[model samples]
Target: MIEIFTVDAFATNPFKGNPACVCLSFMNDEHSDDFDQLFQKIAKEMNLSETAFITKSSTSTSTYFLQWFTPKNEVPLCGHATLSTAHILFDQHLSQSNELIFETKHVGQLKVRKLKENFLELDFPQGQPQPILLSETIVEELKQKLCIKSDIKGN
Candidate 1:
């Protein structure tokens, strides 16, 4: 049976910060279409912003294969969810090493290290932001809604 956990990341207390559902799967076999469907189903049921699926790497003791899914679709990367996954692993003593590596399909390897004072550090590649053009009317609307008195800029 797969183990599941709901963890709150970036929170000092329960019910605060972002909550993510983490599913721990023991199956080391290659994922099939059915597996993808099942993960999506579970994410939908959880109804969270993102759900993380983690499996032990077949080659490394400290490495795991990780995937993130929203209620509707799969995403390439999610920081809060990744942190939640690492928190679960470290909290449950699932990893023998203090440093753990997570391999993602799109983002390559993400390294997470446990720190003092029950903190965890994650190192991942930075995302490149794409510029989007916005009309002046839309920008004005946004400024008004956000109660900004100064000019707003949007590419």
Candidate 2:
């Protein structure tokens, strides 16, 4: 049977932080397609933002393979779900190592370290946003909504 942990991470309150379904694999793993379907079904059942599945050796020597799924679809990387998975592992004493490595579709190598018993440190890359120039029509709409007039004219 697959071992699963439902964990709340990143916040003290149960409902405030993200809720994640963490599953650890053992012998005779589920098929890829079945597992994907399982994730989709469980995610839909939980109706959470994301759920994570992690698998590793008993010694934790092998890298942990992680997959994240949203209620609607699969996501490349989910920070909160990853943190929740790590938290569950750490709490269970399964992860004795100070640092936990996660390989994801988006984040190639994710490092999650334990700062304290309840605190975890996650290191990931930042997503940069591109600048968009607003058109005069959009600006006018904003002004009308906010009741503020701009002195600049349309180019």
Candidate 3:
């Protein structure tokens, strides 16, 4: 049996913040043959930004295979989902630890810390956008679209 919960982190009111579907572990459980299909089905059923499934690990305390699926696609790293997941685990699973570690795709070893005012803070990598120059044709198209003849920054 997969226990599911809808967590509202970063906001107390429903639909104000990002909603995530969180699935907890149960004994003698194994995902179906098409796990991705199942994930997508759950995500669509929940109609949220992301859905997370946690399978209990048999050998390790700090280890579990974590997967995240968005409504449109599967994302490697999602800051909001990570925060929601950690908040769920801390408040529901782990009572003694205020911080939770998550092993993710791009942002490996992700940490979510509990903050005052019932907010959770997530630490992840910073993505920097490099400046790029658009071609003359693209510039002309943008100028025609927005009716502005100015330099447009592209990344």
Candidate 4:
């Protein structure tokens, strides 16, 4: 039977952070049309924010095939789910190394390292956003939604 685990990413306690499902060897090949259907069904069963399917990839010795799916559909990249998968691998000793490289369909290989017990670090590609004109509409919305909250004991 395939081992499926649920992990709460970025939280010390369960149910605190975004929960994701990690399934090992969920499928054999990606070429099958039914593969995606079954994956979505499993994700729907888990009913989490996202579900990750891990498979042994032949791209490299350190690379593992990884795919992410939401209950509704598959997503390109999901940080929390990836983190959850890494946590599971390290926690259960499923992997031989503390560092892991994941091969994805879109964003290329991603890396993760175990920092300490119950802690891990993710390597992200550097992104530089192009300059854009400030929109008053967005500013007003942000001000209305997330303005500020501070009170130093009524000081």
Clashing pairs for model 3 are none
> Across residues 1-155, which tens digit of lDDT does each residue of candidate 4 receive?
65799888888887798889999764344433356788888998888889998776766554677889988999989999998888877776545677888887778888999877887888865556886655666655655687644421210
What tens digits encode model 3's per-residue C-alpha lDDT throughout 51-135? 8865544434544445688777777776677777777777776756666666554555666777754677777877778977787
Per-residue lDDT over 5-124 for candidate 1, one digit per residue giving the tens place of the 0 to 100 score: 888889988899999999876435553445778899889998999999976677586688899999999999999999898888777765456888898889999999988656889997
Q: Candidate 2, which ten residues in sequence have the lowest lDDT sum?
A: 25-34
lDDT ranking, high to low: 1, 4, 2, 3
Q: Model 4 residue 41 lDDT?
A: 87
Which 10 consecutive residues of model 3 have the lowest summed lDDT?
25-34
For every model shown, the clashing-pair count is: 1, 0, 0, 0
- CA lDDT scores, all candidates in order: 0.84, 0.72, 0.67, 0.77
lDDT per residue as tens, model 2, 1-155: 55767777767877667677876652124225456787777777767778787655233453476788888898989888888878876776545777787766666778889898888999976778886778889878777888886675443
Q: For candidate 1, give the lDDT.
A: 0.84
Itemize residue pairs with steric clashes in candidate 1: 133-155
